[model samples]
Target: MTVKDRIVEIIAEQAVLDVSDVTMDSTLEDLGIDSLGLVESIFAIEEAFDIQVPFNANDPTESDFDISSVASIIKAVEDLVKAQS
Candidate 1:
């Protein structure tokens, strides 16, 4: 599957939402993802792609934590997948 597909799958699985509920602009908050869910999703992403996402508290909008939209999440995963390749 493509990175976007994988991201959507992750969001669906982690957020406990239907695949159809996920959209490119859908935010985690919109999907009812709490802090714990967010952390779980991050861990799932890390394990799925076998990449460690660096943390940066100074930048709350960093890709790893800034899962404001499905597009952004997909971009982050794509970057990690590319890096590993």
Candidate 2:
């Protein structure tokens, strides 16, 4: 699957929602994913893609990785993957 599709799946799993329910505009808050879930999702994404995401769990607002929306997360991951490759 593509990066976007994999990310949606990971986020959906963390939120305990169906993949079909996740949209590009949806935020982690909108998916009912709390801080712990967000951390878990980030870990899963990192493991799945073999890349380290520049996210600070203690201070999400200060982090470079954007989790504002599903689309943003997808874009960030895609960019990371491209840069690493």
Candidate 3:
């Protein structure tokens, strides 16, 4: 699967929603995902892509990783993957 497809799957699983239900504009809160769920999702993404996400659990707002929207997260992960390559 493509990175976008895999990310959508991961986030959809975390939100207990179908992949079709997760859109690029959707936010974690919009999907009823709490802070813990977000953290878990990040861990899952890191493991799946084998890339370190620059997220700070203690200060998420201060972190470099953007989690504001599904599109942004996908872009960030793609960038990280490219950097690793």
Highest lDDT, which number?
Answer: 3
Poorest lDDT segment (10 consecutive residues) of candidate 3:
57-66
Q: Give the TM-score of candidate 3.
A: 0.97
Q: What TM-score quantifies how close candidate 2 is to the native fold?
A: 0.97
* Residue pairs with backbone atoms closer than 3 Å in model 2 (clashes): none
lDDT for model 1 comes to 0.79
lDDT (CA) per prediction: 0.79, 0.96, 0.96
Candidate number with the higher lDDT (2 or 3): 3
Q: Over the stretch 1-85, how does candidate 3's per-residue lDDT look in tens digits?
A: 9999999999999999999999999999999999999999999999999999999989987888999999999999999999999
Q: Model 2, range 7-83, lDDT digits (tens) per residue?
A: 99999999999999999999999999999999999999999999999999888988889999999999999999999
Clashes per model (N, Cα, C within 3 A) = 0, 0, 0
Give the per-residue lDDT digits (tens) of candidate 1, residues 1-85: 8778887898899888898999999988899887778778878888888888764535647536456688987887787778889
Q: Is candidate 1 or candidate 2 better by lDDT?
A: 2
Candidate 3: residue 54 Cα off by (Å): 0.7
TM-score for each predicted model, relative to the true structure: 0.84, 0.97, 0.97
Residue range with the least summed lDDT across 10 consecutive positions in model 1:
56-65
